[model samples]
Target: MSALPCPCGSGSPYRDCCGPLLRGESPAATAEALMRSRYTAYVRRDEAYLLRTWEASHRPAALEMDDDAWLGLEVLATEAGGADDREGIVVFVARYQDQAGVVAEVRERSRFARQAGEWLYVDGETHP
Candidate 1:
């Protein structure tokens, strides 16, 4: 079977992008990669993966995946979130449709930290 496109908008097959990360087979190498995998996790409604990748300080007790349908993800920019960086930032936009079919978008500048060779999501600043 052919691989599906990654929801992270990475233009690569899921197996080559976020699939491994989501499956706990590999850790995200960079902050941007971690951000992309997080986006994919949202699309797949993989709450466990989300929680695992989240920083302990910011991780919520649980995630609720209701009726909202995630449509797409767009990565806008990145700063200092390379393989060797301890800290990184990623700006992105996520689009979704609610129960009423109303389209909505959330833009955010997210922070990430690398600890013990793993990238963890810290927090995000949502854009109005």
Candidate 2:
């Protein structure tokens, strides 16, 4: 089956953008790519992919994602996370609609690391 548009707002279909990465068809080449794929994972409720992309040091033992309905993702900026870089940062805003039908958005600057030729999310500091 064909996938939908990537929730990461790449304007490309999920199959072409983050789908392959999420399905383990390929590894994210950059920090921003990892961040985008993670957001898409949240939308798809693929907790396994979420945990896999997370750094072990910060990865939680378990995740509970049954709450809010994720609406969309908007990547704000990036620094240093490239194919050759060992570390990188991505700034983004993710919008969600709660069960109450109230909409909210969260802004974060996330850090990532490249280990064993794979980029993984380390941590993030939310913006007010």
Candidate 3:
């Protein structure tokens, strides 16, 4: 079986791929970068970064993470692109261990919004 690219593939090395974005680089010219950074946020458990990117209406008091768990991301797809008004649609599955040391998966279709001149994570649909 062929191994899948990093959860936020974007066809680039995980570090160079999402590093720039998480470091404040704009989404990839092709919309892939946005998807990747979102993954990186999960990997690093950057609650502040995640909150800053989330739209206010949906923003939570704080983002949560399993302190003892490590997370990885895989970006399945991204669609709806544009330079004026970009929309990043990413399918990702996050893998991590729970308090009991059981491995688990979280699948979601995330929606992103770029308001004014910044790309922000909006919300998503969870499946499984």
Candidate 1 lDDT score relative to the true structure: 0.92
Model 1 TM-score, 2 decimals: 0.95
Ten contiguous residues minimizing lDDT sum, candidate 1? 1-10
Better of 1 and 3 by TM-score: 1
Give a tens-digit lDDT track for model 2, residues 1-128: 23777888888888899999999999998999999999988888999999999999999988998778898888889999999999999999999998899999999999999999999999999987
**TM-score per candidate:** 0.95, 0.95, 0.73
Candidate 2 residue runs with Cα over 4 Å from true position: 1-3
Q: Candidate 3: misplaced stretches above 4 Å?
A: 1-15, 25-31, 82-85
lDDT of 2: 0.92
- Among residues 3 or more apart in sequence or in different chains, the pairs in candidate 3 whose N, CA or C atoms overlap within 3 Å are 7-73, 7-74, 7-75, 8-75
Residues 1-128 of candidate 3 have per-residue lDDT tens digits of: 12334446456565566666666654445344565666667767777667776778888997667564645666676676456666777677878787888888888888877776667777889999
lDDT of each: 0.92, 0.92, 0.66
Question: What residue pairs clash in candidate 1, if any at all?
Answer: none
Candidate 1's displacement at residue 114, Å, is 0.2
